[model samples]
Structures are given as structure tokens and as C-alpha cells.
Target: MLSLQLIRDKKEFVAERLSIKNFDAANLLNEITALDKTRRATQSELDELLSKANQLTKSIGQLYKAGARDKAEAAKSRSAELKEQTKVLSAKLSETVELLNKKLVELPNIPHESVPAGHSDADNETVYEEGEMPTLPEDALPHWELATKYQIIDFDLGSKVTGAGFPFYRGQGARLQRALINFFLDEAIDAGYLEYQPPLLINEDSGFGTGQLPDKEGQMYFANEDNLYLIPTAEVPITNIYRNVILKETDFPIKNVAYSNCFRREAGSYGKDVRGLNRLHQFDKVEIVQIEHPDNSYATLETMKEYVANLLRKLELPFRILRLCGGDLSFTSALTFDFETYSGAQKRWLEVSSVSNFESYQANRMKLRFKDKNGKMQLAHTLNGSALALPRIVASLLENNQTPEGIKIPKALQRYTGFDLIK
Candidate 1:
């Protein structure tokens, strides 16, 4: 959410920036302006009423002290009338404030100046590419086939026990999954991120804090009995740790990382796109989050991008980074960079991670603030990226590393997996 002050003071400027995001803010802007006016008017009236009531009380006390019994009785009557008026005005003020908040949350974050004005992933800008595309044997199999060949992953077993998209790892496949999780966490820790293991089930407030509620409510798995939603990413719980917190200038850069089994409904998913490890209901991921001063945030975003790139390099995967256009950007992100790895057998680039800088959108929603050098409170910029998402990375590794003999594991992960190849 953007600050209400920004909307009111620079209505036209804000509306123009939102246009870059393909958001027609004309009606919503008008709606917000009107609601804010009503809220202010109601509050003014309530304040005046309270002031009058207090004066009446003082008059009643004076009358009683002077022994003017008749005057005191009349003053008491006026005081009662003012008290009733106050209650009515207070209710109106509350109603107006609530309506104002509803309108505010409907507005998406303002796009950064660098955000390209366009629609869809096709309009995204490719900012970086690295590594060579591997030349695989003609007999090389896609990840699902390779999984079957090596007896690593069991999709059929998962379907029988829990339905599709919930895969069961067998023997070496299970070990490989564990190894990937540990490796990702180790890498994040080495980059100075504090590790956290957050709750898989989060309450409504936590969801709203991360902008996952309202807009994306249907995308998450809801636990109806407890009214909690299963986390779609570790980013939710980990970022919400600083909700409603205020920090000093010394805490300029707050970094955290978490490993979790994420769940999503992925409703309406079908066909080859969702096949095998391409998409899944349950998947493993290591997430990195940061809270930083506004002046340092963009620099920190670049650092995070490089860190994720390093991971791909170590894994020896051919990868590229795309700067997402407004349409493809997440609702809460001001700027986003998506990392895609080339899946050799699939002959397509699969998205493996998205790193984003939210500016102050999420911080405004969660009240995550810090005191500046001037000792004034300001909203901190928030950012989170997948250090690595397991499924697609696993798919790329299996597809690209396949040989007639076996699938060769990257040397960096050999110690973790306890084997150089899955035969």
C-alpha cells in the first residue's frame, strides 16, 4: 500500500506512474480523494463535538459550585445532549476511515521509473545471460523420464497417496532433494543471511502483511477449520517477522533466509506446462528477504541478483535474467527480475526464481519502519527473492546432465549428495 499522504499530495503524479503499470487510476483516484475528504470532515466534526462537551462539563461544575441549582440542572441536560451527539459523530468517523482503507488497499504499488510499460512476459526485457547451452545426447530423456530411469522420483505414487503435483521421492531422489535444500541454505548463510524456519500455516494478518490476501486468496490452500492459509512461499512468514516493528538507523540492512515446503492450489493449471517438475502443488524453496534504507535498496537488489546468479553458475546451468514488464510484475513488487534456466531436454527456458524490490509498498502495509538519521520515522524498503526453487532447478539438472550411462551431479553438490552420478 502507498502512503495516504503521497496519494493526497501528488494525486496526478501518482496516477501517471500507475499508468505505466497499465492501471487506470482515474476512477480509483477520484474515489480515494472523495473518501479521504469525508473521513477528514467526520473527524473534524467529532473533535468539535468533544470540545463542546468538555466545555459543558466545566460549566456544569462552575454552576454547582456557585449554588445556582437551576442553572446546574440545565447545564447537565446540555451535557447529556452533547454526549449523544459525540457518540453519533464517532460512529460516522469510524465508518469513513474504514471505507478509506478499503479503497487504499485496492491500489497496486507504483512502478519504478525503470519499469517498462508493456503487457505480459513477452514484453519483458532480458538484462543478462550466461553459460553455454549444453549439447545433450539424442537419447537424453526429459526430467520425468530420467526420474523413472534412475528410480529417483515417483509421481505415480504421489498421485495414489495425495493426488497429482505432490510427488514422492524414492531412495536417491529423496536424498537429492534433501541435498539441494541444504546446499541452498548453506549458500544463503554464507551470503550473510540469518536462517529461519517459519510456520507452514499462517494467519490472515500475516497473509495481508505480505499482500497475499484479497488479491491472491484463491491461489493459496486455506485451512478452513482454523481460518489459516498454507504459505505459498516462505517469503510470507519470514517477511512478516518485522511487521509493526520500528528499527534504528543501525539496522539499515536486515537480511533473513528460510527453507520451507510451500503449497499452492495452482488452480486451472493443466497440460504439458504442469507436467513433472514444471509446476507442482508442493515444492521446496529457500527464500531470501531484506529490509533496507531507501537509499541503499536498489544496490542491495543488485547484490541479491548476483548471489542467485552465483548459485546457478556453481550448478553449471545456462541461465538468463529478465526484467519483468509492468503486466508480468507481481502486485506488490515495484521492480522484479526473473531467473530462467535452460532445460536441455525440454528445449525451453524454465523460470527458477524471481527477485524483487518492493520499495515501501509492503512496509506501508505492515508498518515496518525505521528512524532515519534525522530521527524521523520512515517506511523501509522490502525485498525478497528465491535464492533457489527446487523443482525447476532439479528439472534442468536432470534434463541437461543426462548421459547414456547416468545423470551426472554437479561437482559442487557431489559432497552433499554423496555421489557424483545417479545411475
Candidate 2:
């Protein structure tokens, strides 16, 4: 949610920036402005009425002391009328404010000036590429086929127990999943992040605090009976820990990380793109979230991007980072960079992480503020990234590291896996 003051003062600027994301906010801004005007006018009227009623009460007391009964009675009557008017005005003001807020939340965050104008992922700019794509044997199999050959992941068994998009990791596959989780979590903690195990279920307020409610509501798995949502990412619960919190300027950068099983509906998804671990209804991810002072947030964003890239480097995967174009940006993010690892057998890049800076967008919604040096309250900036989502990372690791002997584990992950190869 943007501050009402920002919209009021920079309506044109706001609308123009929103255009980068392909959002036509001219009409929405106009409606919000109109509603705001009405709300302010109604509030002024209510305040004036209350002031008048207060004066009338004082005058009525003086009149009664002077034995002016008729004047006192008339003053009381006027005060009652003013009270009635205030009630109507107050209600109107409340309603107008409510409507204005609805319109405000509908507007997506303004993209940073550096964001490129584009319509889809294809238009994203590749800012960095690292390592080397592997040269695999012609008969090398995709992760799914390899999993079956090794009896590591049983998709059919998972489907029998639940449904599609749910696969059971068995034997080495399950151990690999555990190893990755520990590896990612340890990496985050060593990088100054406080580890947290957050709840998998969140209330609507938590969802909205992270800008997931109205925008991505359909993508979330909702428990209708409990009115809670299954978290789509640990970012929601981890970042929301600071919701409605006020911190001193000294708490400039608050880093936290969580590992969780994320659930997403992935509606309308199909074809080879959704095959195997490319997409999942439930997936494991270690999310790193930061609440930073607005002044240092962008710099913090860069550090975060590099941090994720380093993880890929350590895993010895061929990776590239793409600066997301306006059209591909998330609703709450001012700027985002997506990291993809080359999957050898698939002959394609798989998105393993997205590091994003929300600036003050999520902060405004969450009312997460800080008292700066000047003793003024200001919205803080929020950022989060997938240190790495396990599914695709695992997929790439298996496919790229395949050998005649077995799938060789990267050196960095060997200690965790306790073996050099998965056969």
C-alpha cells in the first residue's frame, strides 16, 4: 500500500511509473483522489460540528445560571442537531476512507527507474553469467527418469497417496533434500541472518502484510474452514514477523532466514515446463528476508543478489542472473533479479532463486516503520530471496552431475551428503 500522501502529492508521477509495469493507474488515481477529497471534507464538517456543540454546552451552562431557560433549551436543541449531523458526517468519512484504501491497495508498487520496460521473461536482461554448462552424455536422463532408475523419487506412489504435483523423495533423494536444506540454512546463518522456523499456515493479515492477499490470493492454498493460507514461501511468515513493528534506527538491517515447505496452487500450469521438479504444488525452500533502512536497501539488495549467486557457484552449477523486466516483476517488488541454473539434460535454464527489493511497498502494508536519527518515523524497506529453492536446484544438480558411476555430488555438498556419489 502506498502512502496516501504520496498519491496525493505525486499522482502524475505515480501513474507514469506504474505505466512501466503496464498498469493504467490514471483512472484509479482519479477515483482515489475524489474519495480522499470527500473524506477530508466530511471530517472537517464533523470536527466543526463537534466544536460548535462544545461551545453550545458552555453557553447553555451560562444561560441556565443566569435563569435564561428558553435560551438554554434552544442551545441544547442546536447541540443535539449538531450531534446528529456529526454522526452522519463521521459515517460518510469512514466509508469514503474505506473505499479510498481499497483503491490504493489495487495499485502495484512503482518500479525503480532502473527497471527495463518489457512484456515477459524473454525480455529480461541477463546481467551476469557464471561457471560452465556441463557436457553430458547423449543418453543422460532428466532428473525424473534418473530418480526412477535409482528408485529415489516415486511420483506414482505420491500420486496414489495424494495427487499430481506431489512426489515422495525416497532413499538418496530424501537424503539429498535434507542435505540441501541444512546447507542452505547454515549458509544463511553464517551470513548474519538469524534462523527461524516459521509457521506453515498464516492468517489473512500475514498474507496481506507481504502483498500476497489480494494479488496472489488465487495462487495460495487456503484452508476454508480455518480461513488460513498455506504459505507459498517462507518469505511471507519470516518477513511478516516485523509487521506493525517500530524499530530504532540502530536496527537498520534485520536479517532472518527460514526453511519451509511452500504450497502453491499453480493453476493453469501444464506441459513440459511443469514436468518433474520444474514446478510443484509443494516445494522446499530456504528464504532469506531483510528489513533494512531505506537509505541502504538497494545496496543491500545487491549484496543479496551476489549471495545467492555464490550459493550457485559453490554448488558448481552453471548459472546466470537476470534483472527482471517491469512486466515480470512481482506486485510488491520495486526491483527483482532472478537466478537460473542450467539443467544439462533438459537443455534449459531453471529458475532457482529470485532476489528482490520491495523498497517501502511491503513496509507500508505491514506498517513496519523505524524511528530515524531525526526522530521521525519512516517506512523501512523489505527484501527477500530464495537462498535456493530445492526442487529445481536438485534437478539441475542431478542432471548436470550425472556420470557412468552415478550422480556425483558437488564438493561443497559432499560433507553434508556424506558420500561422493548417489548411485
Which whole-number lDDT from 0 to 100 does residue 275 have in model 2? 88
TM-score of 2: 0.95
TM of each candidate vs. truth: 0.96, 0.95
The lDDT per prediction is 0.94, 0.93
Query: Residue by residue across 1-423, what tens digits does model 1's lDDT show?
Result: 989999999999989988888899989999999989988898888999999999989988898899999999998988899999999989988888888888899999998889998889999999999999989877778999989989999999999999999999888889899999999999999989999999999999999999998789999999899999999999999999999999998997899999999999999999998899999999999999999999999999999999999999999999999999988888889999999999999899999999999999999999999999899999999999998999999999999998877889999999899998899
The C-alpha RMSD of each candidate to the native structure, in angstroms, is 1.7, 2.1
Give lDDT for model 1: 0.94
The segments of candidate 2 whose C-alpha lies over 4 angstroms from its true place after superposition are 54-77
Per-residue accuracy of model 2 over 130-198 as CA lDDT, tens digit each: 999799989889999999988889888888998889999999899999999999999999999999999
Clashing pairs in 2: none
Q: What would the TM-score be for candidate 1 when compared with the true structure? A: 0.96
